[model samples]
Target: MRAKKIYWWLVFSLSALPSLYFGLIYFLNPRQLGIDPVEVLLAESGQWAFRFLLITLLCSPLRRLKLRFLSRYRRMLGLFSFYYASLHAVIYVVAWIELDWPIFIQDLVSRPFIYVGMFAWLVLLVLAATSPKAVVRALKKRWVILHRLIYVAALAVMVHLWMQTRGAIGEVLLYGCVLFLLLAERLYRAVPLLNHQSVGKSANN
Candidate 1:
């Protein structure tokens, strides 16, 4: 029990420190962020959001590989994804648009990427809100169905990133490949043939 607590504490610290450092740098030394600090912060937060979402999805594959301990940290990683996503939205509203509702609505209409990103954020919001143990318990099997929307949210994020990029699609392609593999692994596990193979192997053993 002590070890598990220590492991999660380490995970939380490692996950949070970079965000905290960037936040402080943005506020205390805006000059350090270059001329486009708002853009930099927005990208940084959004990237972290994507990363955490990927990590959350990776947890299941890792568990299948026998790293069951990772399951415990999945919820924390998912919540962190939402945290950075919310920060990204707040920066867009407060810093970029300066809370001008008219401009905000206009940008959302003008930028299809913004629309996709916001939709993804909304799905993350739903997942985060229902992440509590009590809520999960109450939802029962339905919780699993609702949380499966993470895959959709991830696809939306990739599209959001892809649309925002001008040239250099290398990074986007890399992340997309990773998402593809994760999805493939999930499908592989779900296939009845694979299940039967596993059962046969166990029986033979």
Candidate 2:
């Protein structure tokens, strides 16, 4: 039990390394991030958000592949995903936009990608808000239905990423492929059960 606790702490610390690394760079040697540190921060945070989200999505498939212990850390991974997403949003608003209401309004009107990214972040916000054990217990079966919105969030994020650039299709495609495989696994598992349910219903009829 003590060993398990230590392992959990280790996993938690490792999971936080990305943010810590960025934080230290920003504080210690902001020049390393280039001249536009805010833009660098925004880009890195957004990328890590998707990376962590993809990793969180992988937990279920990994468990199915016999690495069941990963299931225990799924919630932690998901929260980390939300953490990076929130960080991205905060940096964009606080530093990038500098709370410039007029500019923000102009961007909202002009940039469709911003709309998509905001929607994804809002979904993440909902998921994070409902992530607590007490809330999960209170929500009961509804929790599963609500959490499925993570897929929508992931899809929106992909759209947001794709919209951001027309030049580099490679990075966008990589993230898209990872999300596709993760989603495909869920659909693969669900189809058989859905077919079985249909057969059972027909037999009962």
TM-score of each: 0.91, 0.92
The TM-score leader among the candidates is 2
1-205 in candidate 2: lDDT tens per residue?
9988987898799988988998899999998989988789999999999998998888878877888776788889899999999999999989998999898888878888998999999999999999999998999777877898999999999999999887879999899899998988878877886767553322100
Candidate 1, residues 1-205, lDDT tens digits: the string is: 8998899899999889878988899889988987888889988999999999999999887876788776778999999999999999998899988999998898789889999999999999999999999999999777887898898999999999899888899989998999899889877766865656654432100
TM-score of model 1 (CA atoms): 0.91
Q: What is the C-alpha local distance difference test score of each model? A: 0.87, 0.88
RMSD of each: 4.1, 4.1
- Clash count (model 1, backbone only): 0
lDDT of 1 at 170: 94
lDDT of 2 at 78: 91
| Deviation in Å, model 1, residue 128 alpha carbon | 0.5
